[model samples]
Target: MKFHNKKKKSSRGRAKWHALMTIIAVLMVVGTGCSVGFGQNSRKNWEKNIAQETVQVEGLEGEYTLLFLTDTHVVIKDSEVSAQEAEDQESRYPMFVNAEGVPAEEQFPEWIQYANEKKVDAVLLGGDIIDSPSEANLQWLKEQLEALDMPYLYINGNHDWTYPWEYMTDMGRERYLPLLEPFMQGNTAFQRLNLGGLVILGIDDSTNQVDAQALDRYREALMDNRPVIVMAHVPFMTQSALSKAVEAWNSPVVIGAGNFGGIYPNEESEKFISLTTAADSPVELVLAGHVHFYDRDVIEGEKNVPQVVGAAGYQGNAVLIHITGTEN
Candidate 1:
């Protein structure tokens, strides 16, 4: 589907000016002796917010590093839209800024620069890279990701595809598939990338449910006999993450959990969870982001799976994961 692009030059200029003014205003506040905590939020100090962790696989043959980020919530309005739609996009800008009032549009490039500098094996974007499926946002996301020196996998987050005015339904997701297909590699629902000995599996659970087709692909990935790491938008239900999500959002926002005023898994989602958490499952770790906070929990089974939920990228949050295998 073709997206409307009108008044591109003027719209982009306005967006840039608006962002510049925001940064100036924040600097003014900090200069006026306001205790807005600019120390940690300084633009040059954004790297201080990145969190790092390392995982070891018993039979793995080499070491690979990945840069994981999510929930960037980038908002850009470079194409023609309704006044109300433009206002909606503008309203979301402040919601995703760093403490220093730097927007995701600014922080995202920095994150990519870090990945390129570190030369990580790959970049895992857990989803919600854009605030919505606006043409401007999608174009910006594509440009940033394509410029990366290494391969990157991007999954869908709830906000990436749905417009603020539309209800999130299966049909709604299908409507945007063509626009999103270019970044999804081959499949918009599920994707897999093999890094020689370690495999990274990306599944789109942005709608809080996994497609039956995705479950089939997941099973195939499991048969590869390589250590696998699953990445998705929503985190699975674990007691710790559940409690934290409730505390933070005052609702159940996870997947595979029974109905409790939150999203309940459908048959496919239930089966997907069963396969991932099975006693003999080969999933070594799960990485996700949606709760907008950092958390780690072990999904209980005969063998527990470690799950790491990353915080929001708009706040300059990122996770540097080091995967190392036994030496040959």
Candidate 2:
């Protein structure tokens, strides 16, 4: 695939661009007004906030860099939403702000700008790209992503489909698939992107569960013998990551470790976990976010694959992943 700076011409013309910019500016101003005293020192300068990690892939031919972002809970309401619903969405803005008090909707554009400037091979949006499935949020997300200079893969997060007042359930998630399908590329459950010797698998474990079809697709990917990197909304269980999550949230908020407190995985999710962390598993890295803090640890299989849990994107947290091939 081509990895170059190519600006996507807007079909909506300059009016749309100006309108989007106006909205973003208003959000930044509102965010600054609320937390200006506390976050004054933390504004702008996206490069300084990036956390870097590297992994070695045995069969890979060359080095690849990916900008991984997650949990950017942006809320943009349009006319379709009720006034009460809009107010509810606005109430959630403060939770996702950074130290500088900039909301996710504002910080997201900067993150995308950084990615374009750096020109990474691909961008992996692990999930929670928006606060809900509102028409405005979906439209804004599509515009920003389509404008990217590099390729990107997006999967659903629990928050992406659910409204501010609703509980996250399978029915709620399925209710919005039609709205989210444009971003899913082909399959809503799983999607794969090939970058030379590397294979990136994006799974919709937004609800902390995986179905049989996703498991089957994962199994098929393993058969190809390519070095794999899995990205999802909820993280898998590991000793260090799990402990940190429990301490932070007072519950086990990860996948495959619900025995500690959170929802237990179903049979298919269990099988998926088993395959990913198996002794002979080809998965070299796992990327996820949901607990809203950065944690890195080794999943305890015989191989001990590295897992990196990115912090919340709204707080200006991002991971710059460098994948180097072992084979010269």
| Maximum-TM-score candidate | 1
Error of 1 at 208 (Å): 0.9
- Candidate 1 on 37-95: residue-level lDDT in tens? 56434444455387888888988888999999999999986549878778888788889
C-alpha lDDT of candidate 2 relative to the true structure? 0.83
What TM-score, computed on C-alpha atoms, does each candidate reach? 0.84, 0.83
Model 1 segments more than 4 A misplaced: 1-47, 259-261, 326-328
Off by over 4 Å in 2: 1-48
Q: Every model's Cα RMSD, please?
A: 13.4, 13.8
Compose the digit string of candidate 2's lDDT tens values, residues 159-187: 88887566576677567766888888867
Q: What local lDDT score does residue 148 receive in model 1, on the 0 to 100 scale?
A: 97
Worst 10 residues of 2 by lDDT: 1-10
Winner by lDDT: 1
Give me candidate 1's TM-score against the actual structure: 0.84
